[model samples]
Target: MTYDDLLRRAAALARPGHRAILGIAGSPGAGKTTLARRLVRDLGDIAAHVPMDGFHLADAELDRLGLRDRKGAPETFDAGGYAALLRRLRDERGEVVYAPGFERVLEQPIAGAVPVPPGARLVVTEGNYLLLDTGSWVRVRGELDEVWFCAPDEEDRVRRLVARHEEFGKSHEAAVAWVLRSDQRNAELVAGTRERADLVLTAAQLPEP
Candidate 1:
């Protein structure tokens, strides 16, 4: 879906004296983050971002658990921690709450990067496993006011994912390999949850440059 349409949908869901949380879920290269950023930008200062990537396990923790190679898999994140943050967001304690954000260059989640002020009108969260039925994720949908699943063409999705890995320092060959193995697996899992989303968005139209 176009970013403008998403923003308008979110705005309608927003209410005075209440917080609105929207989930943008998709495969790794389906533009969930891009859509989330555009929503926040279009929604202006009252909007905040709270991505699920922030709950990724530290590199050390991943190593200890023998999950370093499966970094983007569902098990690699702190699902419970993410759930707790969602709970706090819903509670509306009137105090600013801080959450981590993952840095691609550092390949880790940096603490205190995403600050969700208590009074923000909107919280736009994007991630792969938000709609998954396993673990704490099952309760995640209860916290979101709306959930949109992005589904780009499969070929386009794979190409974007390969390019992203290459841009992030992976060799061309390595990028292709990762997409075929790890990324494709995650994509299949994410696709299975499309039925759970409130909206299924196909973002094929590129905005004019």
Candidate 2:
């Protein structure tokens, strides 16, 4: 889909006093966050980002659970907490609603960093597992007005993941290793959920508007 197409869909879903939740789901390094950021930028202040990454368990917690090596795996995140936040952000009436934000430097979820004021119209939530059929993820789909799956070239996605890891302080070998062993596995799992998306967009198809 084109960028203009996204804008139109976002606009149609924007209603006063109604929380609009749009899910952008894709494989690791598929530019899900990049697409979400662009949508939020185009949609302006009426839209706020509430990423699924914020549900990631802290590195220390992962270590305590003996799942540090599988950091990005489906079971490594707080899926229940994420689901509850989505429900509250979409259903409950409140003056101020707060959501967790992921800290890349610390590789942990920092509580209450994203504040969704009482009147936010659109919430662009992106993540790999939003469409997963497991557990609470089933409830996630029922809450979204629409869901778009972003697909980039597989090679490009892998390269981006490797580059991202290297930029985040991992050695080249470690970056590649992690991307192949963990990130790629997660990617495969997310990719399987494409059928659940309302639209499928290429990275280049995003419009400037």
Candidate 3:
């Protein structure tokens, strides 16, 4: 429906005692991060944000593996490690856990950038491949209390993606080329996993700024 509905749904998950994880899954530019952050911000101290982008493989590692060109593809991420972190976040309730975070300008992951204190009862994790049922990614869903998919208008999504790349250092042409040649392929793959999500949210369903 609207942001109010999402807020209510998220609030219900952050109950007393046990911790809860709310996963937001979608393709690049579908606004998963935007939605996840908004939920955490609105939910106040009970929620913490842990993004999947934080799990991206370093450029050096990608170069060594000959995957430098396919940076945003699922193969370029530490899927197993991401899954393991999710498991820890879900199980380790009392400690002050830390999670990695990604820097868009540097296109690198920063370790221990996010802190999830014991007071945080909910963790909002957003990513592209959370719903993927392949390889180590299959372990992710088991750790989440609920997963919601974001499916925005295609034209708008592509536009935002291109602008994001351009904002991060790519030229307009390079950004367009990357979005069409690489991101689009990954987007299609993520789209296929939509049916597996507990709920699907569209542009109109997201929060109003």
lDDT, candidate 2, 19-43, per-residue tens: 8899999999888888788888888
- Per-model CA lDDT versus the true structure: 0.85, 0.85, 0.92
Q: What is the overall TM-score of model 3 with all chains considered together?
A: 0.98
Writing each residue's lDDT as its tens digit, candidate 3 over 1-209 gives 88889899999999999799999999999998889889999899999999999999999999999999899899999999998998898889899999999998888999999999988899999999999998889998888999999999999999999989988999999999999999999999999999999999988997533
Candidate 1 lDDT, tens digit per residue, 1-209?
56566667888776777888899899998988887887787777678889999999999999999999899999999888888888888786488989899999888999999888866778899999889998888877778888989887788888889999999999999999999999889899999999999998875532211
How much is the lDDT of residue 184 in candidate 1?
A: 87
- Alpha-carbon TM-score of each model against the true structure: 0.94, 0.94, 0.98
- Among all windows of ten consecutive residues in candidate 1, which has the lowest summed lDDT? 200-209
Compute the lDDT of residue 114 as modeled in candidate 1: 86
Clashing pairs in 3: none
